[model samples]
Target chain A: MKILVCVSKSPDTTSKIAFTDGNTKFDEAGVQWIINPYDEWYALVRAIELKEKDPATVIHLVTVGLPDCDPIIRKALALGGDEAIRVNTDSSDSYYIAAQIAEVAKKGAYDLIFTGKETIDYNGSSIGGMVAELVDAPYVSLATLFELNGTTASITREIEGGEEVCEVSLPVVVSCQKGISEQRIPNMRGIMAARTKPLQVVEPASIETLTSIVNYELPPAKAGVKLVSPDNVAELVRLLHEEAKAI
Target chain B: MSVLIFVDQTEGHIKKASFEALTYGAKVADQLGTTAEALVLGTVNDDLAALGKYGVKKVHQVANETLNHVDTQLYAKVIAEAVTASGANVVVFSHNQTGKAVSARVAARLKAGIVAGASSLPDTSNGFVVRKPVFSGKAYANVSINSPIKVISLNPNSYKTVAGEGTAEVVALNVAVDASKIKITAVNKVVGEVPLTEADIVVSGGRGLKGPENWGVLLDLAKELHAATACSRPVGDAHWRPHHEHVGQTGVQVAPNLYIALGISGAIQHLAGVNRSKVIVVINKDPEAPFFKAADYGIVGDLFEVVPKLTEEIRKMKASA
Candidate 1:
């Protein structure tokens, strides 16, 4: 089985967020980057688990970014990916990225494709569906559990108030979230092997950039908290009703 | 030039998020000097004409049983066809589960620029610019879509639903429905008084509550407020609460109107999921807990004592009001 796992780097969750260049770009001056948690902990780890069950299963990591994304892809490789592909481009538009991934998926003819539910930075949650549409494959988002049997895939996804169990044929796209797999750390041996694994770079497909960022702004800062004394519980309620109007 | 809002439904009932989308779409239509219409797939039990109260001019139905459950492939095809037939230049959706699953595919099919998690109406003064929360609500981005056709999915709870006195004309739309490639075997629904995503207010607890045995205090407060109950990651990890109730970076993200946290230390991961809420109240015994920094109102006291008194005060307030 050949599985293509999509990987990307995001600012570490603890990093302070700021924008640069007239608020049109994220400031990378002091930002620390990590493999997006959903991609690393759920999508990539689940692919590794599938490979462990069947040694013949091949996992290929694909990322769409500039060369700065190499270290992040290497970390994913260390986890268990057999090979990696980098679409040499720096674009944040979801359509452009999905189109590039679709081009790769078409050329590779993989049986399954995986992506995290959404990148933490953009939080769009649209890539998997867009990729599936471009590739003309069935897509499932927010998958919590996945199992493969022969040519069929059984997947469970979270809906509004419940879980939906679904079955689809091979060559399907899945966007994974938590509950799909646990986090894994790369060991010394795997890290060394990753250094030898092939890192292929390819040009991006020619796709029109659908959207552009005009500017960025920070959320309004909170007015300092109103510290209600523990003894005056009724005052808090009065404040909620009269001052904040939140109740 | 018309705005078409997709009304999401599950088992024939319209989702609360759909109402927000309708109101938003209507306002956008007013901005564009056009009419706002609604498109609903599958067999619906609700009064479709009454949706005009939210400002829609008409409600279009496809009335197919297969669409009762979401098939992303088929839904996208039908929605794309509907958009073309109706000549809708702008499409609106509530960025809920169904919207997240299907909107992008529809946009791809129609070759339109799409924005998910849109926080505000498009700024149409110069061009169509929409504002959306980025970095998990830590910041905002103004996005410009240059495509002739545009698709937008509004974030849940970001827009308020406004209903006025009006009735819409219900029309049946003719569209082709393709067979779905995926088959749903079972659905396990969580039994709760309020669905977490749609709740206006949420009451959450953490490991500081001690254990599952002491959850009654939280539940009682939630009941009085008519709010959904959620938990921090550790509480969900320890199985004190179901995994669905977990709200953090890797769990469910919520933007309720009011969020009350009891005993949570406000990890960054937890804050990412809920920083979008309009008002936050934190109650933790430790004065230095990180949650206090993000709270609009805070009380540095034991939740065991503070929660009951707060609940009682609210009950008395509600009783007299």
Candidate 2:
């Protein structure tokens, strides 16, 4: 089985958010970037676990970003991916990114395509479905569990109040989240092995973007917390009803 | 062309989020100087005309049993047909589980520009610009959609659902529904519990409460408050709670009217999901916990002591009222 895992770079969970260029650009000055947690922890890890169960399986990592994102791609390889591919482009648009990835998947003809349900950064869980449409394949989103069968795979995806179990054949797109698999850290041997893995960079096809960022801003700073002592717990309830009107 | 809103319903009951979408779509339609209409896929027992209170001028109903449950492909086909038949210039969705699953496919089918997790009405003064949260609510991005046909999925709890004094004309839409390629084996569920997505108030706990055995304390509080129960990602990871109750960047992103968090440190990821709540209250033993900064109210004390007392206070207050 050949699985293609989509990866993206996101600001570290603890990094303080700041924007540059008059709030038009994300300030990378003091930010630490890591492979998006959803991609690394759920999608990629689940694919690697499937590969571990079958020696014939191969996992490939793909990302659409600037060359600066290669280190993150390499780290994905160190974790367990057999190879890495970078679609050279700016990922400012989700549809354009999906088209580029779809073009790559059409050429590679991967049996399964994996992506995080939504990127931790953009939080737009659209690409997998877009790519699935572009490639004329089935798409499943928010998958929390996986069980593969011959030629077809049985998948379980989260719904409003429960889970829906479905069976789809190969050459499908799946957007995964937590509970699909456990996260794995790269050991010294894996890191050394990743150094020798194939890292390919390809140009993005001339795909037109339907959306563009006209501006940027930050959420209003939470006006500091209202404190009520533990002994004044009843007062908290009073404030909730009278002041906050939350209840 | 009219602005079409997908009014999502489950077992004949229109979801609260869908009402938000209708209100949002109506406002957007008024902005564009067009009519606002709704499209529902399956048969419903509720009075479809009542939806007009949200400003929808019409409700388009497709009486199909296959759509009782969400089938992404089937939904995409029907909605695309509705868009064409109604000549809808723009489509709106709630951006919940069903909307998140189907909106993209509809966009793909129609070759339209799509924006998910939209938090504000579009600034159509210059084309169509939408503002949405990015970096897990840590930041916001304003995107411009140039496509004549556009798809937008509104984030739940972001838009206000207001009613207007009006009546809608219910129209039956005829469209060919396609057979589904996938088969659903079974649906696993936890009955008699409020779905986290639709809960107006939520009570969540974290590692500070210590273990799964202590969940009853918070659950009791949640029961008294008539709220849903939730937990931090770490608690879910430790298997102390079911993964579905986990709310964070990688888990469920909820925005209730009132979110009362206990014992959870405010990690950026955790803050990403719950920051959209109308009011946030954090209770923890540590005074300096990061969650306090984002909370509307903070209580520094043991949750074990504070929660039981808080629950008792609520019970007495309710009895008196």
Candidate 3:
């Protein structure tokens, strides 16, 4: 089985979000970039699980970004992807990223495709569905767990009140979330093997832009805190009813 | 032209979010100078025609036993076909879990431009541009779709469903139902006293409640308000509450009108999920807790002292009302 895992590099969640160019663009200075946690922990780990089940199985990690993304791609390779593909293009809108992935996925003839539920940066879960649409395959999203045997795959996904169990044929796309698999750390052997693994960079296919960010702005700063004495419970209630209007 | 709205139903009952979607679709139809129609799959006990109170002119009933359960792949095919057959240029869905899956697939099948988690009506001012939350709830983005057909998934609790007096014309669609290939193995429901997503007012306790034993005060407050109960990730991880009741970036997303946080520091991850709420109230012992920053109102006092008093006041207010 050939599986493709798509991931991105995003600012570590701890980074204090700031913007430059008069708040027109995100300030990347002094910020550490990490493999998007969702993609690495859930999506990539599950892909590794699939490969473990079949030694001959091949997993291709794909990302669209500058050459700097190669380290993150290599990190995913260490995590258990057999090979890596870097589309030599700075990641743009979700539409363009989906288009790039669809181009590679179509030619590779992957039986299954995997992606994190959403990138920490964009938080757009639209890519997997759009790629499924572009490739004309079934799309299942937010899968909590999945199992594959032969040509069929069964998935468990969380819904509003309960959960749904679904079965789909091969040649499908799934966006994974937590509960799919435990996060894996790369061992010494895997880390050494990843350096020797084949890493290919291909030109990006034509992408039609659909949307652009006009500007980026941080959320309004939180208001100052209020303190009330623990003994003054009635005062707190009064404030809630009159000032907070929350009672 | 017609507008097709996907009615979300479970266990033979339609969800409140679907009603908002139906109302939004009806308004979009009015904007286009067309009639709004509904497409229902499962067995709904409510009077379908009465949905016209929300501006639906017709409700297309597809009472197929196979559709009693939602299969997104199959439902996508059926809804896409319904849009084509009904000659509808616009398709609408509630941006909930089920709607999120099917809307994107239907849009792909129809090759229509799609927007999910829409907060308001289309621009309709000139071309079609829908505003949606981006980067969680921190910001907004406007997407323009020049395609002939448009698909929108409305965010729950974002729009109020306005009622107008009218009766809908019920029309049965004769589309062939395909037996689902997927089988439901087992359903493990959370069995909550109050489902968090559907709750109007939520009272959530965090690590600040100190320990599970002290949780009684929080539950008492929730009960007094007839509100649903929730917890932060740590509280749920500690088994103080069921995992399903955990709300944050990694758990369920909610947008209740009123969200009360007790003994919780507002982490960015937690804020991302509930920031869309209309009003937020934070109660904590420490005045400098981060949650107070995002709170519309904050009280600095020991929750043990303040929560019981607040509950008493609300109970008295309710009794007097």
The candidate that achieves the highest TM-score relative to the unseen native structure = 1
Residue B44 accuracy (lDDT) in model 3: 79
lDDT of each: 0.93, 0.89, 0.81
Clashing pairs for model 1 are none
Higher-DockQ candidate among 1 and 2? 1
lDDT of 1 at A177: 92
lDDT of 2: 0.89
**Collision count of model 2:** 1
TM-score of structure candidate 2: 0.97
Deviation (Å) of A243 in candidate 1? 2.0
Q: Regarding TM-score, does 1 or 3 come out ahead?
A: 1
Candidate 1 stretches with Cα past 4 Å from truth are none
For each candidate, what's the DockQ? 0.82, 0.76, 0.41
> Which lDDT tens digits does candidate 3 get at residues B1-321?
899999998878888899999989999998889999999997778888898899998999888878877776678778988998889998999988778777777776676777777887887786887777766777666666656888888888888888889999998888887766566666655565666786778999999887888989999999987788888988877888766678877667788878999998989888877888767888888877888788877678788888998888788766775
Number of the top DockQ candidate:
1
True contacts kept of each: 0.77, 0.76, 0.33
TM-scores for all candidates?
Answer: 0.99, 0.97, 0.89
Off by over 4 Å in 2: none
